[model samples]
Target: MLDKTLRNFDIPAFQQDLINWYQANKRDLPWRRTQDPYKIWVSEIMLQQTKVDTVVPYFQQFIEKYPTPYALAEADEQDVLKSWEGLGYYSRARNLQTAVREVVADYGGKVPDSPAALGSLKGVGPYTKGAILSIAYDQPQPAVDGNVMRVFARVLNIDEDIAKPSTKKLFEKIAAELISTADPSSFNQGVMELGALVCTPKTPSCMLCPVQEHCRAFADGLEQELPVKTKGKKQKTTTYAALLIKNEQNQYMIEKRAENGLLANLWQFPMAPIDEIGMEHITNWFFAEYGVQMNIGDKAGTLKHVFSHLIWQLEIFHAMTMQTETADERIIFVKPEDLRLYPFPVSHQKMLKYILD
Candidate 1:
């Protein structure tokens, strides 16, 4: 099927047109300014499930702080999480740091140039590996991410469900074969850029597409229907109660999450499940965990945060601490202003806003 699909279009012309259009019209992103493997690696990791516009400032700030693999590897985990505060996917930051540490320890603090070496690092999957190789090293590798998949599906008029692993493999194969050996970097970026700006998911700008003449979906008037994807499983909603405990000096109590779970190593107001036992159970759990007695007060506010796999319905509660001395190392009491130094998940961040406001 892939061979037959290639036969229907002029491959050379398609590549040339796409590359020309990209070089002429590509967005002036910060990452595009340099072929530095470390910078490109950072940008690519941050770009996963995140928009380019949103990533720009984060990328700039992050690179300024941790300019090299050695810097990132040497930074504290909490500091790293703080640097990645609003980026949402905290694990990406953690995993990238871990991988960078490996690079420093084993690969001489340089991001590996070859595909195989880059791929062996933690969190460096196929797309990231290909991106690092093609964009940084100018290797003829295919980075078939969602945007690329969308572009290829429309260009080839493929109707396979993109959510399936098999579909991703097919797209990767097609991209590898189609990649321009002389300039894979621009070609891959062009494909993604075209998908992002012109061949949008809802309403593609067919007339403005550079490769429209060779696009199978354009010829068939089926651009919108070509990149088929199955719907994901429904996200489970879990109810939690976030406690804002104030000490005698008006300091708020916060706790760091366990090192190996969702939102790991991030700070948050002490929280407990809002189960059948209700606020009483939450209070009990808080006291048990932190060794601090709490006098629960009026409800402050409610905040909802949605992750990729679950929805958190957080109910905020104001409370006064009955005991100041708690031996738990994970728990800390700090003035409200001090909270700025810690990284809290968006849910807790919203609750903090209500407390401060």
Candidate 2:
């Protein structure tokens, strides 16, 4: 039944068209060459919610620094976070490190080839597992990314709101059935490439499309109308941070963020919620938490940071402590030289320089 449906679908022509186009047009991405599941895994994770050009240098630098799972596992969290700086979604970096540790401990530092095993790794989701299994292990798994979603919707003339879960399942089922039986890597890359290059979300270059003839949307003159997406909820804006920095005797007082919030487990200058950052609020928080008296100094500056759902308008303050502090409770003072050994988000780092300079 599947074969019959595919026969009437011009599968060969579309496959050949995409394959020929890919042979001549696919970009020379480093991850495309090796069947190393580790390399492919890293690339796919970095590529999520990120662009290819951004992932390239990061991938190259990361692989150069930590060439193996064992190496990545042995790396300090600070070093790992530093490497992942500027690539937001800091949690992904933390999860990647956790996953490396798991791979080293359970799999003996060799990345698993099976989809089930790969999917079991920390931070390895359905799309990532599919990408690794197919691109690295030659498994006929369909990696459904946004590009693939768009391509499948247009190619099949699907209009059941691509945002719907049922629509996604239908696309995945069709993708698995249509997957090339040979060299799944090439086939997967061909689909991803066609979607990214020719059948883009907006202003698709249909005149240059390889499988335009097989595209039901193109045949119906609805290529621009397919893959209907429902509007998403507005990203709520909330502000909750104002970084505070204290520089004394070449040391900066920095605090480790809680392990669950944005940029968790990363170092930052002592920060309080926006509502708790005035002169009175800072003094009250310090007295309540540490029983220490502090003389609030000049306002160094404010740093504005944006997350996917929240915005932080941080007003940094400089201050001097009443006594030499020990690294005991919430805040710790570290020399500027030692500060380099810790990973601080850019927002905190910006405030640190304001005081250190």
Backbone clash pairs for candidate 2 read none
Tens digits of per-residue lDDT for model 1 on 1-357?
888878857878989999999999999999999988999999999999899999999999999999888899999988999989989879899999999999999889888887778999888999999998999999999998999999989988889899999889999999988999989999999999998999998889999999999888989999978789889999999888888999898899989889988999999998788865576577677777778898889989888888889998888889998565689999889888889899988778877786678
Quick one: best lDDT, which candidate? 1
TM-score of each: 0.97, 0.90
| Residue 144's lDDT in candidate 2 | 81
Number of the predicted model whose TM-score against the real structure is largest: 1
Error at 170, model 2, angstroms: 2.4
Give lDDT tens digits, candidate 2, residues 1-357: 335445578766677777788889999998877777788888888999998988999999999998888888999887888898777788888899899899999989888887778889889987888888888888889888778889878887777788888777777777897777776677788898988889998989999998888988899999889789998665654444353434456566677778887888787776556464554576778656555556677777766777677667777666666454754465777776677677778776676576557
lDDT scores for all predictions?
0.89, 0.78
